[model samples]
Target: MGSVIEREHSATGSMALGQWAVIGMCMLFNMINGLDTLATAFVLSSLSAEWALNGFQQGILLSASLIGMASGSTFAAPMADRHGRRPLLLASLLLSGTTMLLSFWAQGPWSLALLRALTGIGVGATLVGANVLTYEHASLRRRGLAISLQSVAFALGVSLGGLLAHALNETVGWRYVFLAGGSFTLAAGLTGALWLRESFEFLAVKSLPAQQADHRPALSNVATNSPVPSLASQRLFGRGYRQHFSTRQWRETISLATAFFLVMFCFYFVVSWTPTLLVQTGASETHGIKGGMLLNTGGMLGALLLGLGANRYGSRQLLLGFLLLNAVLMTLMVPATQVLSLAIGMGFTLGLLLNGAIAGLYILAPQIYGTGERASGVGLVLGLGRLGSILSPVVAGVLLDAHWSSQALFTFYASSLLLAALAIAWGRGGTEERAGRSRN
Candidate 1:
């Protein structure tokens, strides 16, 4: 009896520690991902001057990383479902870090784009892998908060990157920024390899029924001895793509992807060009960096607030409200950009609402697919969604070259946000809350 009680206590301790470990480590990974991914944006001003780049060329440079991100999300992220999240995450981190370091040596636009693209792929894969890992570990009731924390960490990293560039670019030049970011990322990869563990759900799914039966006697002493209930009984990917999901599932997935695409399009446009746009409006390079930092700082706060309220108020309702607010903010940003103070304030607000709404979408994502296909499902959506990111910068470049005002561009994107909210409203509701309640 004493031994049984000890075993039960050990099991409980392991379970609690495992959850914390996954969340804490994944959050760290996401922070690094954000820092490395946004480093280029932070340094783009210096790079543009150095290369004597045209507007179209600048847009291409910004879009190159995003294009790589799209490919990584579609192809590399899904590998987590088969190989396990930890391994894929480590590999991506290493790849990203290596490429970022290599980018420091880039002599021209072509070489720089190539390196940035490779780094983006790594960052993209890491993003998807970390999300899936965190979601699987978090209880349903706290999933929103957990994912929000990840977003908060990411935003914090972006803010830090901007600040670092602002402080160091003049003193050290842009090359050192990549050097620092790459070194930190490689360190993060090592930390993950040492400390991270495979998702329990993935482990259970991989364990054979016969093997489980053989282990039952050993696990029976614990009060909660059963394996985590599998979200789907179907084989991973099944016989074919069509056989894996029903028509309803497909529709829901497509709707989520559409919403993701639209929001990301708007988000990346602001992120990629806000600094340059600020410069065009007569702000110093320092002020431009400050503007970017303010946007991310607001994003962190917005994500925290949304996470706290989402469970109580309902994810869908919060999402809609946030998106609506984002549209209003984006429209207002037109006139706000004319004044330095106003632009800073508006940029923060825009980041808060826009990023907060996106966080809500991340909370809703894992609910749409079963465990068997969750990684692939999320990856595919994010990958396809990156198309919007890839195009937004290039499109914005063309328009800017044609002498389009920032006011007109933001207003157009604001309309797109409304359309995205409508698309999300038309989709299926999340089952995660219900699942969490049932499990409790």
Candidate 2:
């Protein structure tokens, strides 16, 4: 079985038709899932007016699907490990598509939130299926490049979704936006149910449960945390802070998790609020939609840029550079808001830096862990990042409710990114020092 697995992984260059099909399907899933996850954001302005939502309520609405994503990540992603990737993927797609379709009739913020949460479950679960299947399908040499496209597809989805929402919202109404996303997602699910192939690696692992008990069959295994990056210091600032990171693995884990948390915190804040805020500045939904689209458009480019740079410069170094750049961009975001073009340009730049930072983390995470703990370590980092994602909008909302200005809010988040950059640098230095000691 191991020999067969090695042979399959050894195939290089062009993939089989079946392999391309599976990988393409997963990318499609990721793309639609992106649209489904951010569906509410597209119509937030209308929803606010219809429901007379306060900043806090609006925050909850923006955050509802994220909360669902966390739930799905916890409960559903793991199911693929047990039930099989194919089944999980199909089920999650159907679940997400159905909920998104149902969202067209959501009566209030709470109802919309409920539907969005369900959609997020599917979104969350599909991530596991997409990532696992992508890794399993691609040739070994091209695996990293292929899997990175998932991030590109996600950004594409959001960008296209902005265009879709504008057209639909202008022609008909906001409900149509949800309806469109749900229908397309459902159509994809149906197509996938018929055509999507199971992961050969998954089947191989299942053939020998004895060998799989302690480790994933595919450990280099595209550690996406389902499409991402965390928070803790010696258990996040405990007594043995120095001793805690004395070990190489622990140092990597803590530093990476902290970096993940801070980046996601800032990333979600920008993703969740930019459209609405942009709308406020110009008194126009077009401004918001354009800003949102440009942000994602930049992200698509950023993912590619990171992929190119990681190949030449190194993922860790490039990631730190992106993070530091993002911190500066975040602080300047408010000033950009005053001018429509400037605001949108800043959004694009921030998207480039922020998404690049995120893709960098995803690219680097699996490298830091051994097979036995890859899943756990990546999961921990991802979970913390999700927590940050969930909290960011709510925190922003509360601050805004208290009448905080955009400049202050952005500056505060920038500080988190700076701290995150520092953590990554510290981890790199500490891990190197520890290895130096061991070698001696």
Best model number under TM-score: 1
Query: How good is model 2 by TM-score?
Result: 0.78
The most accurate candidate by lDDT is: 1
TM-score per candidate, in order?
0.84, 0.78
Cα lDDT tens digits for candidate 2, 1-440:
23554535444446667777887898898889878888887888888988899987887777778877776755666566556678888898899988888888888888888888888878877775676567667764555556667778888888788779878887898999999998999899898989997766556444544534334334223222221111121112223223223464677778888888889999888876788878877738977867777888888888878866764566678888998888888888887778888888889998888888887776655455432233334444565567888778778878999999888998999998999899888875322123334555
What is candidate 1's lDDT per residue for 376-438, written digit by digit as tens?
778888888889887777677788889988888898888879988998888865655444445
Clashing pairs in 2: 230-257, 230-260, 230-261, 233-236
| CA lDDT for candidate 2 | 0.72
Clashes of each: 0, 4
